[model samples]
Target: MRGFAQLLSGFLLEYVPRRRSLSENTAKSYRDSFAILLRWLADGRGIAPDDVRIEDLSRENVESFCLWLSDVRGVCAATVNVRLCALRSFASYVSFTEPAYLEWASALRAVEFSKSPSGEVEWLPVEAVNLIMESASSDAREHAMLGLLYDSGARVSEIANARRCDLRLDAPATIRLSGKGRKVRIVPLCDQVAGMASAYLAATAGAPDSPLFVNRSGKAIGRAGITYVLKKHVAAAHEADPLVVPPTTHPHALRHSKAVHLVEADVNIIYIRDFMGHSSVKTTEIYAKISSKSRQKAVEKAAANLIMGSAYGEEDKSAIMEWLRNLL
Candidate 1:
């Protein structure tokens, strides 16, 4: 255990470049999975940090741990899979260098990734988005955050870690976002989002080195702080009365809603691709699923074409008619 963690950590740090390293989201995810696995081994097997051995995790234990995570802990399978992958990567690293667990590494490689996914979380419903956006208090940090999320389609963590210098005041209002893999992408900011961000920047324009948004003490925005703002004000803004039950919402749902809205507007896939800064055009393709209304409009436009052979010459029409008759 002593050698495993320390060695793996050192190697990963060496391999993953500081500036071009794993995306912030990926780092967070790997950390979470490693924590869970370390806890399970320590508590369940009574293995000390120094005494732990990779071979201690029998093939059966690896599979069992995954199932235990999903069933007992109430975690979704996708989450369980993520943890397994992280552990596997660490195990592979150990196997290559330690030689003590070469066979264990082979066993680890035998484990197959899940093919079919489970647990489908629907994006924010139309009404829910309206409720959440309207829930924010006017002229405040939360309100500005809500507008930024909807308008920019940024992740919660991104918004939480945004800096004062990230905003580009130039035309088209592009924002320089440090995405996953330390990959920086420039996302164009809409006028409304830019206006709100400008206001926020102005209010807290303390230093270029400072955070774009802060709390009372001028500290960087924390996850819980942003969640509190969203739950209290943003979602509540959706209700007819702020005191009443407001829109129940989640961070990703708002992003999904924004994508769906763009899809509905017939925005080109490539355009949305750039706006969302997705790693691949394939990921953005999901949004192209047409709504019933859009489908209906498509049918309406093609309705004239349904009058088969109308544009053909009378003889050609007769030939098409004959072909149709023969098929009948």
Candidate 2:
């Protein structure tokens, strides 16, 4: 029997990171999923991770592990699905490499993922966004960071990984974002954000290789650090404007605000998808559904009778008659 430990190590160390070239954060998440699975197997089946064989990974055991993640560990459906995905991916690798484990791998692959709820994206109101921007203007780093976040709509990890060389701050300024799966997309920066970023970069004496946003120690800021900066300004904005600003908002809220604002501004959905580095247009359509103008238009189309009924005879008589003709 093939040692599960060796296979697991090779999968994580060789395949995921080296072969697939996934980010360290993603690799860590996959590693953690397997760790939880191993712990469950030990507790439930008296199988140590190192001692477990390929034959132990039956469909029943895999289903039980997923159930334990939800029922015993109290993890959400999304988390369970993530674990299932990892297991399926590993099973696929095993099926290709070791023909003897093909049946077990097929069983693992047959396991279905749990259905997870799709939560609505939370975005800040325009007034609240204005207030936050105004407050951040007092601090150069915060101003630049927040401006870039709103203008580029980059993910937190992408923003954190941003280098000074990625910025094209001259005319028609743009920044290249390193997206998931090693994909790169260039997002244009608004003039206002470009100006802020230029000034902040100058003030910090940043070089082409230096991180765009760094802590006082001159190290690149992590996700937590960026979140702290956002939280600080959110608190200030909330205190300054209690009615407009939301009391609880995060960095991603700024990204969501940018997407919603773009949809409200009558920007094309395709352009927004490219700007936001979304893999699918379906992801970009969420912003359209959330836009107040889009919702208002839908409402008006639905309730046209209230406005048109009063002047139906004079204004829309020809169209109404045409519709009546068609119905008759």
Candidate RMSDs in Å, in order, are 19.7, 18.6
lDDT of 2 by residue, 193-268 (tens): 9999998888887779889899879999999998998888887875454435555567888899999999888999
Total clashing residue pairs per candidate? 7, 0
| TM-score result, candidate 2 | 0.55
1-328 in candidate 1: lDDT tens per residue? 3466676575456532252265555555566676676778788778766666556667777887787787788764445656676666667767766787788878986765443243343354455566565656475577778777777787777777888788887777966666677777777777867877777776755777677778778898877777777667643453232222223446765677788788877789898987777878888877675344335544543443445445766676556555644432
* Structure candidate 1, residue pairs in collision: 23-180, 23-181, 131-238, 134-237, 135-233, 135-237, 135-238
Candidate with best lDDT: 2
Candidate 2 Cα errors over 4 Å, as ranges? 1-118, 292-294, 297-328
Measured against the true structure, the TM-scores of the candidates, in listed sequence, are 0.49, 0.55
When summed lDDT is taken over every stretch of 10 residues in candidate 2, the lowest stretch is: 297-306
CA lDDT scores, all candidates in order: 0.65, 0.81
- Which candidate number maximizes TM-score? 2
